[model samples]
Target: MTKNEWEQDLEQRELEKKAHNRGYRAGVKTEGEASKRVELLENVLLEFVGYDDKCLQTKPGLLKRKRADLVDQIIYQRQLMRELYNHLDDDVRLKLRTKVESHIWPVTHSED
Candidate 1:
């Protein structure tokens, strides 16, 4: 084989190796699973808001519902983080929460 053909083959092999190591094969999440996840997130956020608003209430049903929502949210959030962290560098994953929170609501120091 010519030098150009040999170089192309080496580059192709390297690309394949990287793709295999990264688990980039198709069919990760099905459509139904994605939809269910979205529904769970919405329910969790709604329940959380309700819980925050009714902090004075002691209704058992509401409390149970809120607890269930929170559990689902935590599970889904952890799954998402795991999937994201798999593709991101360790440092970025480690600082993800801090960076997101700081960007959303930066702290303001007042002079006393």
Candidate 2:
């Protein structure tokens, strides 16, 4: 390719790379938020259940509904996490894994 063509190609590649990185960062942020929600829901459920275990012991079917809602949140979080992993680049996934292994537990990785 000509020099101008080469430069144009290089610029395009850079743009693509930037876009991919942005997507990865956004995914990480999404997963982080969902994970936090899951944790919060778990804590709340634990406290509620601590008050009473059985439906009769608890506040009627409210606890059950709450439990089900929490479960749905957990499932949604899992799906979001899976979607993130599926769309993200391998290198970005590795970075996320590294964060996991380091015990840093990133709250967000969004560029903004």
Candidate 3:
């Protein structure tokens, strides 16, 4: 092949390399984000419900209730987080968490 043709082929290869690199980087980033999200969720669950390695060791009514409680806690926490997040400014929500410094309000309100 002529020198000009060779250079053109080299340039094309370089472009392909760069495109592949971008895609690879994006995939790595997506995988990493997913991993972190899952890890964080597990950690959060542990924090809220704690490690119950033996909770399911025995099958009865209480064990089932215990498992249900864990699910409820996760759903409750997610709901609280969602409500707090909804109140935040759009710009601040992404950069900061809604820190709960005050007492938690009752989930149900009673008529006076």
Best by the TM-score measure = 3
Taking the tens digit of each residue's C-alpha lDDT, what string does model 3 give over 3-36? 9999999999999999999999999999986775
| Candidate 2 per-residue C-alpha lDDT over 1-112 given as tens digits, one digit per residue, 9 for 90 to 100 | 9999999999999999999999999999999878767765664556544554542224554465557565765676576668768899999999878777556544453321
Question: Model 2: number of clashes?
Answer: 0
Candidate 1 lowest-lDDT run of ten: 103-112
| Candidate 3 deviant stretches above 4 angstroms | 52-76, 80-112
Identify the superior model by lDDT, candidate 1 or candidate 2.
2
lDDT of 1 by residue, 1-112 (tens): 9999999999999999988866644335566557657877765555545666554333664465556565777787676656766998778776885677666767631211
**Arrange candidates by lDDT, highest first: which order?**
2, 1, 3
Q: What are the TM-scores, per candidate, against the unseen true structure? A: 0.28, 0.45, 0.46
TM-score of 1: 0.28
Candidate no. 2 TM-score: 0.45
For residue 111, model 1's alpha carbon misses the true position, in angstroms, by 32
TM-score-better candidate, 2 vs 3: 3
Q: Order candidates by TM-score, high to low.
A: 3, 2, 1
Give candidate 1 regions above 4 Å deviation: 1-38, 43-64, 90-112
Q: After superposition, how far is residue 78 of candidate 2 from its true place, in Å?
A: 25
Taken over the whole model, the C-alpha lDDT of each candidate is: 0.66, 0.70, 0.64
| C-alpha-based local distance difference test score of model 2 | 0.70
